[model samples]
Target: MKTKIVLLPLDERPCNYLFPQKLFLHDDIDIVLPEKLGDKKIPAGLKEIDSFLTKECKDATGLVISLDTLLYGGLVPSRIHNETEDKLKERLHILKDIRKANPKLIIYAFNIIMRCPSYSSSDEEPDYYEEYGREIHEIGAAMHKSHLGMENTLPLDEIIEKVPEKYLNDYISRRKVNKALNLASLELVKENIVDALVVPQDDSCKYGYAAIDQRDIRKAIIKNCLEDKVLMYPGADEVELTLISRMINTLKGRKPKIYLKYATEAAKSIIPLYEGNMLSGTLKYHVLSAGCQLTEAYEMADIIMAVTAPAGNMEEAINQPSKYPEYYAERNIAEMFDFIKDRLSEGKIVTIADNAYANGGDLQIVRFLNANNLLMEVDGYAGWNTSANTVGTAIAEAVDAYHFGTTERHQNFLGLRYIEDLGFCSMIRQKVVERLPEYGMNYFDVRDKEGKISELVKAELEEFIKNELSSISNNLKILKLIMPWRRMFEVDIDVKYIK
Candidate 1:
């Protein structure tokens, strides 16, 4: 079946983190985007999601569109002043024309979490927006906080209380404009423009934290809206649940009950690794193909240990890094490596079932794994990096095999212990580190910055890439061809200086 999902999410920030590329691609779900929404300015070689969504999709069975991008105050180009009722009508008309070209299309719609602009130390809305971000943030915070007593609930009068008397009336007028935009998107259901509406509410929407509380909100939304008529549910842009459901629905010919047994055993070990380490985690798999990476983590475990047992601190040692400016911490990759290595030693296999690692830098990590022979046996997807849930799933799979030990296959369980160095670090990251000392340098300030460094220190740092870091780039290219799927596993190893 051909499904066409026309997605317009709340600017790139919400969509990328919530509905990661790996999670969507794993289920063969095709994501479609309109051209109006451009890239969110991610740096070199990283997969620009807007590029893929807007241009790469093929014909599909359903079209899921996010209304938030259209009405969201956070999106870069959403001009509420310019986007009057007539403009919205014209936009909808264009979308309707596109759908007419696709005969077997069903629509799924999503609303944005009313978000206050998240800020940073340097200043306004973290490099994306200008003054408008602050303006909208004040308005959004007011609207979301109106009419309800709780921290997360709405209290309408609060909007009036907060803004100055001069701007209060104008703020109310703009809020009405945004609310009307939201209503118009929802009204698509009534007009038959879309089949189903998914008004998702994640932690950010309700609790002010950036997470989707799946059990509480998803269940409630399903009961209230998705129960009858068109399907409506609460899920953040993080499409884990929705993708999993689609995979389950696509399943054909039945298999033995042992598969379930293996899955149950696998879940036991893997669940603990991610208890609170990540914002959220959920297990999902395509059954019948033990070839499936999720299953491979279970089948390959050799020395599964008992419950609550202490594995080494390898989880803390290895890191899973991203090139995006937002995730600047260098320890991320080291921590991930530590977690996976420790678990594998305890005879736990790893399956990062939920969070997908999307950037090119992530793919490099896979090469590091394949070089060590851990990629094939350790079991995980390139798009899906190691989150705590995935780490725990690996443990569960190992434990299940430990209890049912046949003993002969134990030797095949390759030792995934972390070694000193397998060779991979982000090149762009190297450039960033080398340039750090030059941050505030002007002619007058040159002595202040350069006086601290010895001649030896200056020379070594200057030659960092030409002599020291050049091998990283060379190794990455060679590894890319041999282990194309391993890119996500690589991390920049500049800690020698970063620390």
Candidate 2:
């Protein structure tokens, strides 16, 4: 009999659903994803997804779901749609029904602590966000501080002084409605409808309205004595994979023992922009969240993780190396070498989180690993978006690899990780963007700014990716690079194994 799981994702992003499905694909395990309601489509899509769940998945060993998917259709829909407050609460019935139908089945679900957009951008936000977004975000930050009994550096009068009164009112109104809905989900935990809950704060900062709401939710969790089962932290994209890992652990009746080594001690405190708290705390939370344990002694580790950070204070945002001082940070690179070699030689399954840069991998780290022929020795690697994104994703995949993985599939996955993080994003994306102006196009032409990149630009990126990733591995071929959403914040790789 197969160990089955039904996963409802936050959105249709390939990374959110497809990657985890692939990683959990074993002869004995089955991961099922229901059809999605198109982005921004609400009640109808939600009904369809729920109906599918009711009809299709009954005997699965566990279910991993996103409340955002059920209530709002997708994560973005949760933000942009104008669903009424009462109607939103009505949807919790679907989960209650699932629980009634399968009383003994384990359920894992996640709810997002919605993001506060930084700029006035309607791309992923509501229409008015393009103008008052920054002010609205700051207001939340100031309000968060006040709730915590901390001094607000910026007075509320000054924070929203420039915004139109109507926009501020509407924004606050929306936040209140959403916050109410999030709180209501806590009741589901009290009712024992969900076995575990993940509330990852999207686009978090030290202080904000979202942070303040998280405090309230944290109190509720404690009040219910559901603290161990509900995992809330500062992350967004990678929670599905993390929970699936935990689900797998539950099914297997085992915890993954892991060891962690960072490039520098400061690497532990370097707060990647979108999260609150230090990097070290987030990592420990992630490990336990995945039903994995961190070992005090390296000898006991089933897997070893080497987290790479910049040697000095530098952010790896752009490809222009000279624009930032400490570009390579050779000191950190040397440290990573010793770390990886030390662990790998000890027969520990090693994974790398090359966070020396953000929005892409550290080229210098990849360059060193490639030059020294240590790239293939590692079990997994992830260098996408923020530190939590990379760390959560890399750790889940690495833990899975340590327990259940094949050489061919693992190599193919690692190749895909490097191809995206290093080959395209770190290097080729900038190259192709540079060529866009020749076609009267710009970087925004291929990125999330405007919807659906031009076919010409897409074609150009495909050609460049082939050149960069063609020789990545003998076992995996560069099948295709796709913009699943037709914009380039994230791309999907169609990897075909060598026959």
Candidate whose lDDT is highest: 2
TM-scores vs. true structure, each candidate: 0.43, 0.91
For candidate 1, the 10 contiguous residues with the lowest summed lDDT are 477-486
Task: Residues 1-499, candidate 2: write the lDDT tens digits.
Answer: 8888888888888778688776777778788887655643233276688777887557877888888888888888888767788998998888888888889878888899888866777667777888888888888887777766778777877887978888877777777878888888888888899888888888787777777878888888888888888878878788988988998888788898988877776677667756776777888888988899999787888888888765445475564353433434433558667878888788788888776677788766676776666666778888888877888888877877867863566666777777777766776666666766665655434544233344433465455445543444455566655656544466777665553
lDDT of 1 by residue, 1-499 (tens): 4234445444544223222222233233445544344323212111243344334323555555555443332233332233465554445553455456554555555553332333311121233224334443444544444423335333545533544554444434543554455445545666566655544332132322212222333455455453332332223433322422233233322221211112112233332221212121222221111112222343443332211111111121124443432233322444555555676676554433322221112334445455554543453321222232232223333332323231222211211111101122222223333553675432112232123322323333334323433433222211111111112222211121110
Clashing pairs in 2: 120-130, 140-209, 141-208
List lDDT for all candidates, in order: 0.34, 0.75
RMSD to true structure for each model, in Å: 12.5, 3.0
Candidate 2: stretches off by over 4 Å: 40-44, 147-154, 311-314, 319-331, 437-475, 497-499
